[model samples]
Target: MNPTEFLDGGTVTVSDETYTVYKTEHPESAAFATIQDENETTVVAEAGTVSGENVIESEPGWKRLTFEMVLPFELVGFLAAVATALADEDISIFAISAYSTDHVLVKEEDVPVATKKLEALGCAVER
Candidate 1:
């Protein structure tokens, strides 16, 4: 999917909360995002809520860009399109896709650059 096709959502909001990734069991909180397997579970939660052992990685200072666009489940390459745009600018990102939308996380320092890249691609970005 190309960026232009998803521009109907029009606004992408950058979250201010700092999130961290934890290596643990199924997270009990709905506030965070998680990916789980037989061997491990990766939980991305607000920094303040994470505590205990097996902390895989802490993304302490990152910003999440929420794509408000209501994407069809059948749509393809949307994340790739966004990632490619950011990667071209040397902005690394961690992405999440939910039932209604897609979100991308970038280092706090790279938020501005990420925003610019997205905007240039026709995505209206809001911080």
Candidate 2:
């Protein structure tokens, strides 16, 4: 997994069962332009969500990126490692996942350090 960190997302949550999200034309979300309104939900970041409905709100000044690698059921440690790496650097990350891979978001400036930290933990990432 040649890890490439693309930090550029914002944190957001939904109050309803359905909402729309806008993507920045990133190659990652090329498969789906919008995640249809569904019952399942979790913390979402605005960085990937170009636009959305259901009264979406979030913390300002944050960034997001998809992990450089693909881990199926190994997300537990993947997340732990990410958290550990960021915790040590005093950085915060908000993460989400799709059926194929996971997405993590940190501050815009913290991208460099977060990238290095995750790389040290055996996760492939790019600067």
Candidate 3:
């Protein structure tokens, strides 16, 4: 199947809350998404929620664009297509994949352009 075909009839919704990506020594229970590995704990949460000593690094002002569709486990290249679309426009993204769908976090300043890029790829964007 074509990579962009997955976008057909799908919607990309922009979240109102700005988020921050934090690399912390310990897991944050309140984080929107947290990944723990032998190296470190990466936490994504609303800006200012996770901070202080445990946090080794923090990058704030990210806006989440949620692909509001259930992507089948067998689907291929969906995220690659989306990332490529945004990259073509020089927008960087932090991606997260859930059991049902995927989300990409772009710098807050790039939301407008990113929205347009996603829309151009056949996904309706909800700002």
Per TM-score, the best of the predicted structures is 3
* lDDT (Cα, tens digit) per residue for candidate 1, span 31-117: 468888788777877776866655555557667889988888777888888888889999988888899899888888998888888
Task: For residues 15-81, write the lDDT of model 3, one tens digit per residue.
Answer: 9999999999998887999989889889999998875888899999999999998888888999999
For 1-127, candidate 2 gives per-residue lDDT tens digits of 2122222221222121222233322222322223443442233433334334432443445555565444656335656656776899999876667676666667677777876666565555533
lDDT of each: 0.78, 0.49, 0.91
Each model's TM-score, in the order given?
Answer: 0.87, 0.53, 0.96
> lDDT for model 2, on a 0 to 1 scale?
0.49
Instruction: Rank candidates, TM-score, best first.
Output: 3, 1, 2
List candidate 2 stretches off by more than 4 Å: 1-56, 74-76, 122-124
lDDT score, candidate 3, position 81: 90
Residue pairs that clash (backbone atoms under 3 angstroms), model 3: none
lDDT-wise, the better of 1 and 2 is 1
Candidate maximizing lDDT: 3
Superposed Cα deviation of residue 94, candidate 3 (Å): 0.4
lDDT score of residue 56 within candidate 2: 43
TM-score of 3: 0.96
